[model samples]
Target: MDEEYDVIVLGTGLKECILSGLLSVDGLKVLHMDRNDYYGGESTSLNLVQLWKKFRGSDKPPPQLGSSRDYNVDMIPKFMMANGTLVRVLIHTDVTKYLSFKAVDGSYVFNKGKIHKVPATDMEALKSPLMGIFEKRRARKFFIFVQDYDESDPRTHDGMDLTRVTTRQLIVKYGLDDNTVDFIGHALALHRDDHYLDEPALDTVKRMKLYAESLARFQGGSPYIYPLYGLGELPQAFARLSAVYGGTYMLNKPECKVEFDEEGKVCGVTSEGETARCKKVVCDPSYLPNKVRKVGKVARAICIMSHPIPNTNDSHSVQVILPQKQLGRRSDMYLFCCSYAHCVAPKGKFIAFVSTEAETDQPETELKPGIDLLGPIDEIFFDVYDRYEPVNEPSLDNCFISTSYDPTTHFESTVIDVLNMYNMITGKVVDLSVDLSAASAAEE
Candidate 1:
């Protein structure tokens, strides 16, 4: 308990575990501890009994729900992009050895009042029903522009500097209507809001290219993928990687109090009167509450269904994004659905989550639009949790605190935070170019 290390990670959340694993692989001694006796902290997947205990305050689950072990419900559900940063990180660490993945069945976007499949390429854009023939032709041209856009090749730029051009300007040049812009910005680029429309087009173009590339990778309906079980496998897989590289882990550790020196920098973490010394501390917002400030709240509905979401063509697993414009909301609403095909639920059972940043006090009412898309729900649970981010400077205190999980149903924002923290802790940008195409599960 008194041993010193380079860093002491105080939570087993996905963010913390990834940092622990990356730092360990970089040869930095890391000691990871969690107050809970589980691998995924706030992100843990709960079985039937645990899920019941969490929401109903009772350990007894209905027999009709099937075996308790048959359910692995993600507390903060998110999908991984086939060619996104998180996949690159997993490939870089070779942690895919501990995990297997399946391509998400579909990705759809809400337009007007109904869900439509998001077109990933120029051909799909031309064939999409979301736009009229002329609009589709215009959108196809825009998609071709994005697809052929090479930052290194000026010929593809068409004499427009995307870095200086606003996305709105680029869209207007192609005469894309508001509806087409809505899906391109929110569905394909996966932006939370329309703010990106006013920002430089470079980032938006990159996101679109990433989406197209990922879609091309698996030739799936969508660019996203999820593990066979659930996202809870992510932290455990990283923890195993950390262990393989000599990182230590301790679970069920009580009262992990961070101790500071007179100079106001983190020196160690104390548990049960024994202090384990370390030069730097990394943890989630819960571990160091005072250092984090409430940013927002996430309202989500967890639904157990007898069938897949209607209008998604009975996809075994899928992601549906209700862009803010369609619903007159301030942010996008995300719907994630998975079934027994992904091994997260019993046969004939499906798990779906509708989540968004809470704009009002009533979560049920806030998530109704998304819930209405699901035909029927056998069992449903509603939850609202406050989101937080570190208010303190890590360089000043040597404490790198991770922000709370956002309401988005993807790993882009989460991986951004992890990579940012890794840079802060190690003073080096994480190189994620490690080729993962050879890995069996890289795009399963």
Candidate 2:
């Protein structure tokens, strides 16, 4: 099949899907391919049920038992696939487990147990035990101030500003109470790294402001726009959109060589025994260009699924548990997603993604238990584990543990860059499912 096209996209990531769609919509012939056998690359969904049955057992309650009916996973796959979406399931656990928390004074409280059912505002979040009193007030004030700005204003300025300041700096500058600072710090650490608190203050503020604005714009928006079935649903949407626009997708076929012209422009790519030619080529992988230039780095992530959602009131959304300390050297970061969407887990289960940034040469056994950036696990997990047995004793049978890595750039940063590249190549702004419209509107 010696066919030529107007453009050739090398990867099947969200950005690749978007570019392929945009180009094809313009009546351009496009060929899209990936070295992997499945679409959505890192975001591809595995069969959680099959994975659970293979690793744990076939007769366990589903992972998303307590979640709302609208967000349940039971029929999400069929619904999404019929609507031209693809989903990959990553089975981490058979049930949702909550980390029980004890106050400094020694009162045991289930973090993910009873529903708080408070107002969805930042103020309401502040009032909850999820954070300290002082921290809640400061966060409320900060969010209120941010909601006042328009993100889409042309004069809104670019790059880091006061709105983007790190949480640590925000706390310090505002003279917030230590407990409040600690809570906010822990929250940020849970999402990224403890060192993330050391990030540019403006960047932190901007991100917080964005979240605040998003909350304000959509009522109960936090639970409204979950990743439909599994996190993989996000990429699946892009994949389906790409296919509808006449782009070809292939997976498991690794690119053996990138054919470049003498002028250094990408001409086409080849994988296995097949060679495809095109005018433009795009590459977005996990390894940083600098690292790939030298020894190359690969990111490792571990998904942990346990019984009963741990430590929180809401079963619909993932609860981020942050570490207390700031100084540490670990590579893995922990993120818990309640399989409120049943596709990934059976009823009554939750999955947690414990990811670490490590070198490709590092052994799986040697990799730390969790991301080091969050600091010591004992400090964060000891109390919670003691109070609530998040993990089942001796572990459940179907708990599946899988590892994945990329040789391009960090997942979060690379994803955004891919979107930007899509905009650059296709001359159109990429629409991220998570509404950045508030940020855009503020800039305007």
Candidate 3:
């Protein structure tokens, strides 16, 4: 193996993959290393069936159940462990199979009546149950303001820009009704409840609008693609593509100490009791600055897969459920289905994700109320899967549930940290991803 390279990337996350792949393509010798044995930092998929068998029991034929041939037999999605070190198997289906929507009264809507696919206009979308009335009004007004802004516009808003506003401000500014404000606030809380309560209303509005625009772009243009096989395929693709371009990927090598020369330039890195020399080093590991301290903050998510996908049809692709007073404060919960893609699950099985933000020290038991499966479960499932009859004594076989902790650092900030460090030394925007950041943060 070569003792030195032009660039050494120290993480295998998405950013690291992009940097390594691009540099290798540009004719620079690059080496990418990950402390873990597998790739795909956060977005990797797991083998769900295998995981279910390991955690619960092996798959067996159901008595009086439909023929085995009717069931979709395939490897389930994989997941990263709670601490982000190990990758394990999950249930074999995608989230759509278990998802259903209902009105506040717990009445189930039929599949045909689940989602009201209205026009893309703001007013029509607001009228749809995808958002609450107040939220719809706020979104309608906000969309009107940025309706003409394109990606090339100098004042285009991004996540940081949106962080400055609040949901209250957006509602008031738009003269939205109290009910509408509550709904919009609830939706925002659901999507970003972790940070929404304290975030500026103006920033929240901007960010939501940005996301809406991005969705619109994807709907009309080439959609952003996730890996077909699994999320793991993404990192593997980068590793394979990197190798094809003369880049090296060293797995299970954890960088212990970063060595810098007297001039403050990163000259080399020591990992797994061995040192590697490089002219430039990029750290792509999750929680860069934050990792230097403790394990970092993370959340717990459970993916439930049901057999013989229930016939529930909800118009919305995702559902946000705010906890009641009895559910305890700080217990934020959300549910979403895999609707954009079908390859994620087998033909007869669908998948759904139930997630809650948890503290690192708390036990999963403390978050049990958030995981209760009985409340509104039947109504929601019936709404989405009305055609199919649920097994008389429905058994949740081979389901997958696991927790993932997100690094305390934001994705955007991490990118900026890398680009700014490189720019200070190289005096240029070395990465296109870096170029995408606003100039305030991009410029050194």
Model 2 regions more than 4 Å off: 48-122, 130-140, 149-170, 182-202, 216-224, 250-256, 271-274, 284-306, 314-317, 323-332, 358-414, 423-444
Instruction: Kindly list the per-residue Cα lDDT of model 3 for residues 1-444, writing each as its tens digit.
Output: 338877777666654564565567667888777776767654445444433443346654333333333322112122211111111000111111122111110111111213122223465556666566666766676556545434455465433243455655444555766434433443322233434545565544444443343334324211112223334454465566678888888888754455667765666768766777777666533323422333224334344344312322331123334332224445444333442233444443334444444443553564344334322321111110001111211011110011122321112323334344444324555423221112112011
| Cα RMSD (angstroms) for every candidate in the order listed | 0.8, 13.0, 13.7
What global local distance difference test value does model 1 have?
Answer: 0.93
lDDT against true structure, model 2? 0.40
Q: How close is candidate 1 to the true structure, as a TM-score?
A: 0.99
Model 1 spans with C-alpha error above 4 angstroms: 440-444
Q: Which of the predicted structures, 1 or 2, would earn the higher TM-score when compared with the native?
A: 1
Per-residue alpha-carbon lDDT of candidate 2 for residues 1-444, written as tens digits (9 for 90 to 100): 157766666556554554565566667787777667656654445564433443456635254433333232211111111001111110111001111111010111112322222223466656666556666676676545544534566344323255456656656655666544443433322234457666655555444454333334334323113333554554455555556667676666665355656865556667776677766655443311211222223333333243433433334344333332321434323333445344455454454333333433453432343333223221111100000111211122111111123221113333444445555555666333432332221110
In model 2, where is the ten-residue run with the lowest total lDDT? 381-390
TM-score of each: 0.99, 0.59, 0.57
Model 3 misplacement above 4 A:
25-27, 41-43, 49-121, 129-167, 177-179, 182-191, 194-202, 217-225, 252-266, 270-274, 284-291, 307-328, 339-341, 360-370, 373-444
Candidate 3 steric clashes: 42
Q: Model 2, residue 371: what's the lDDT? A: 36
